[model samples]
Target: MATLLHQITIDAPASRIWEMLTSRLGLQAWWDGTVSIAGGDCWRLSSDDLESPVTLKVVEEEPDKSLEWLCVQGDPDWENTLVLWTLEKAKRGFTIRLEHRDWRLSEIDLAAENTRWGERLMKLRLQCHHNDDLPVNDDDLSVWT
Candidate 1:
């Protein structure tokens, strides 16, 4: 099994970051997809970038602290994987750490997956900062388009 980790510090409240992680609307603002509650503690994420919708089941949630989701449906490589997000309060804001774990080493392009997660975290940082006025470079836009 393989694990990919990324961390970013954003100058925002933990409560706000927690909301972004837990709410569909807040997720849509940063995540590159159309997010909707599938049912119960599951979320269905669909995007043109994805071959199919990925269904994530919330396995653990600690308000303003951490959240974990298990990939119940999606690409074969992603199935059974775990996505974990942990937030720690910092002096100016919060440090968010993400772990995408339990991957089959033979099934994935580790470098690409790592880059994708890193970019998404940057998007989350920008969203939390309310940087709607800030310009996103073409290279960044190309990733989601």
Candidate 2:
């Protein structure tokens, strides 16, 4: 039950960042290609290789500022674990602060996950600010040595 926070800054506007955070369709690209937010409240996450019947709830939301949610039903340990994404516009670019509460993880896994997050945030900025028209080369598969 430790809170793990990570910060990622990208050269994109708050609106664009919000879209990638909230929209189901947009999230699919980065979140292993399976993201669903249905009935205006629920969050359904699944992977093509490891699908499950779990759904989360949106607890609070503020456009271009913050988005928070927690798993209300399945996976007790993961349930009620909150994900708070806060965005702040900077003089140069934008800063995204992620505060993950009530989530437990091993130190090695934590470092790996956060590194992946940083990479994804960088891709988000590139897709949003640089060129949405051009396709991104997303074939860099995750392989641990």
- lDDT (0 to 1) per candidate: 0.80, 0.65
- In model 2, the runs with Cα more than 4 Å from the true position are 48-54, 75-77, 133-145
The residue pairs that clash in candidate 1, if any, are: none
Model 2 is weakest, by summed lDDT over 10 consecutive residues, at: 136-145
TM-score of 2: 0.73
Estimate, for each residue in 1-145, the C-alpha lDDT of model 2 and write its tens digit. Answer: 6777778777777777776776664565566646655445776776433234446677788888988878776554456778788999987667989876876767775666566556666666666675463333343211110
TM-score for all predictions? 0.85, 0.73
